[model samples]
Target: MKRVAIFLSVLMLVSASLSYQFYGLPYLQKVDDFTLTDHNGKKVKLSDFRDKIVLVFFGYTFCPDVCPATMLRIKETLENLGDYKKYVKVLFISVDPERDTPEKLKEYVNFYDKDGTIIGLTGTPEEIKKVARSFRAFYEKVPVKDNPEVGYLMDHTAYIYLLDNRGLLKLIYSPRKDNPKRIAEDIIQMIKLLKMEK
Candidate 1:
């Protein structure tokens, strides 16, 4: 019996290690509400999305590669979600508040999201800083030396944060590492768990 117990313990450890390697860690902390301007030029609070499984991504529309790729992956994730997509909301928070106006954000997100599920958000520099700090998301502006016309670029964290329907952050995924199918699966799983809890 002791040998069997030891074998089960080893199995559990291996399973957990594999899960973490593939899916990353789950964070179950409650996220505080913050208000930011959406693409529609309206003040929107984070708590407004309490009924949705929110996927928060901090990036600028002018980002040459990472931002667009991540948004496309998020589009693919919503596609994978199928009918459950209605229960999800994607918030694209701009780290570059100077250039990404409400009008520009509306155009940028609409190009990627035809169904209008992805909402682009931008605010004053201080407001952006506060929201970024709350999520532990980092962003910095680097002047473009080679191109004078390009002006500058933003260096920012690329993690996609997942919050449950109750507004508790649950998981963080890397666009370069995690696939859309896996992300969709995790969202569905969280939705199921929330339903079960009720």
Candidate 2:
């Protein structure tokens, strides 16, 4: 069945990702310390979360399916971790900055995290572009030919990027795999590994 095939594929990716000592994780490619205006209207830098593990995702408020679903899985991951969620930070970056202003971003992100568990960020298109490029993520706007008033939609990368407490990039998760539980488990293991190293 189609679902079985997808599960198997996700299982394979998860298996590979668990081998943290191997190729599933990123090395020392440091992310740039970019400034962002967060949903709370606060100027935040990526470095602000240095002591916590950061999970970053790129999408827009107008996303029809993937964004919300991915966010839900992330929330579930946090719930699964229970009290340990305090050690993690989730950041949603708007790929469509034109319509996702700071005010709009606050409402959108709050819908997913009423307790302010996730912070949404939007900046000038140029600033967002620089940030996206820094993370090696890509996004583009596709215009709607049928209705001008309907506006446009964005095509973007859907990987959830994980950065360790020390600010080093660790793993990138695929939402389409529908295996966030495994991803969360991997993250917890990584957290333990990091703790032991300290």
Candidate 3:
């Protein structure tokens, strides 16, 4: 009976420990850096957000559907962050640099920064292409539509990438696979993991 009790205790301990185990996180790979113009027309580097958890998505102001939905979720996630909001940053990179001027980007990105922490970034066409390529995010313009009020649309990869405070690519949330609450939960977990590491 004593031996059986010890084995049961060990099993319970192992099972409890498993609850804290997070298996999918990889040691984040280093990302190439770039300097781009922010919504404020200020030069910003990808490194600027170091020491903070950063969320990134490549989108354009003219986007009809995906961009708005993604931005809304990001806004909701930020709202759900509570006290951790200070340590989080969101970077919206405009894929259509030609039409997405710094001013336009500022308006678009700020609209989603419910807490006023998000940054909108844009640059020359070449610069945009370089940043997009580094992120492995695809974007391209389709032919213009007949409606004069609306212009051509861009088909882009709908990926929300999360980079850790140490500038490591940490997690990715996709619209189909994740909702805002889930995204916020992952971020909270990452923040806790980082705290544990420190």
Ranking by lDDT: 1, 2, 3
Name the best candidate (by lDDT). 1
For candidate 1, give the lDDT. 0.85
Q: 40-123 in candidate 1: lDDT tens per residue?
A: 999999999888889999999889999988988998999999888988999999999999999999999999898778999999
Choose the strongest candidate by TM-score: 1
- For each candidate, what is the lDDT? 0.85, 0.79, 0.78
Candidates in order, TM-scores: namely 0.86, 0.83, 0.83
- The weakest ten consecutive residues by lDDT in model 3 span 20-29
Cα lDDT tens digits for candidate 3, 86-142: 888899999889899989988888777744588999998899899888778898888
Candidate 2 weakest lDDT stretch, 10 residues? 20-29
The number of clashing residue pairs in model 1 is 0
lDDT of 2 at 184: 68
Each model's number of backbone clashes?
A: 0, 0, 0
